[model samples]
Target: MGAPVEIRGLSYAYGSGDLARPVLREVGLAVGPGEIVLLTGPSGSGKTTLLTLIGALRAMQAGSCRVLGQELAGAKEAQRVLLRRRIGFIFQQHNLLGFLTARQNVAMALELDPGTDEAGRLARAGRMLEAVGLGDRTESKPAQLSGGQRQRVAVARALAGDPGLILADEPTAALDRQSGGEVVRLLRELAKQRGVPILLVTHDPRILDIADRIVAMEDGRILPTEKAEPAPAA
Candidate 1:
């Protein structure tokens, strides 16, 4: 198979005609299996927009984007849904249902795959929570956990489904130095072990060391390579 994500000349905009605001311009990118790629840029640079398109969360507006071996342009909603199922997503907000326990939130993701029985789903959820250092908090509601712990639950939820690709947007934005480091460490370890490629968007310099490659963006276009240059703060 090819790279988990491959793009060529991708572009997207909001509005139309003279009122249109372009967010991405002729973007091209790829994320390899088991690779950790960081998308770094200032605010309004279209990093999140690119991530949404690759995750099938948004319809393709223009250009070619193939994610997890599926072409996104012109893909039907059903096809996009299936593609989304194969990808994991993490965001700035933990987005855990306040009433649900960590394991329950993770199991919710398993529901997308009908192949697993309810019991199996729960069991896998427990294991994944443990993997993310949340074994004791499996039954704890999101409200009961600390910010870092809740984010860890979010990570478990994203990985429990055994997705082929992981797209994270500012996952560490709300975290402290120690918490952010722990979160990215877990993600890197899991990605390497499972051979799942990760496309992470972050302006956090503390976690840049986790990336195999850092692609910087500015003004809706990818910046030319400059070795070890840091991304601007959001």
Candidate 2:
């Protein structure tokens, strides 16, 4: 079976003051395993909102969202927390703790999973950082790393748990053009190598070439992109 994502008539809105100000409406899409999907739109187009919903960071007010066979729409808070642990997330800000070293940040995710021994956890964290080109900087804190390096550390942190899916929100926004391209490439390569589906939310057009599919959102609605056959390896 493929690592399929099925979203059906998804809808969401912020604030209870007025229902007219919905952020997402009737959004629907699917991505198979190893697919790199780009979610692009203008500002306030609900790109981030959609990514959050898919990642189980926000409650689904309507419709259904299923990732790796887990339904999120009606899941309880505890269940949502459990679901999130299985998925990797990279935010635009590289939200790393300033006090923690790169290796520590990655290892933190492994700690969330039960029965992970200390040696195995650290080894996995080290491998993830190494994969993102941060092998020697494992001990470096976030403040010590450059913008690109920090973002790479964030990528390493996200991949530490061997998540089945990765949701990245403008992960390359903080880097220079060259560095941004490298980060995007790294994300695509990791998704392919791990057979994990990647949903990247961004307005930048530079990295669209790396995406196997592109879904455009505007005014809280998702427009379908051309469907391609699932990559054989994923």
Best-fitting candidate, measured by lDDT? 1
lDDT of 1 by residue, 1-105 (tens): 888899999999999999999999999988889988899999999999999999999999999999988999999999999999898999999999988888889
Give the TM-score comparing model 1 with the true structure, all chains together. 0.95
Using TM-score as the measure, the top candidate is: 1
Q: Which pairs in model 2 have colliding backbones? A: none
Residue 87 in model 2: shift from native, Å?
A: 0.6
lDDT of 2 by residue, 188-232 (tens): 788887888899998787887888888888899887675544433
Q: Where does model 2 exceed 4 Å of error?
A: 1-3, 17-20, 224-234
Task: Tell how far residue 179 is off in model 2, in angstroms.
Answer: 1.1
* Model 2: lDDT to the true structure: 0.86
Listed per model in order, the count of residue pairs whose N, CA or C atoms clash below 3 Å is 0, 0
What is the C-alpha local distance difference test score of each model? 0.91, 0.86
RMSD of each: 3.4, 2.8
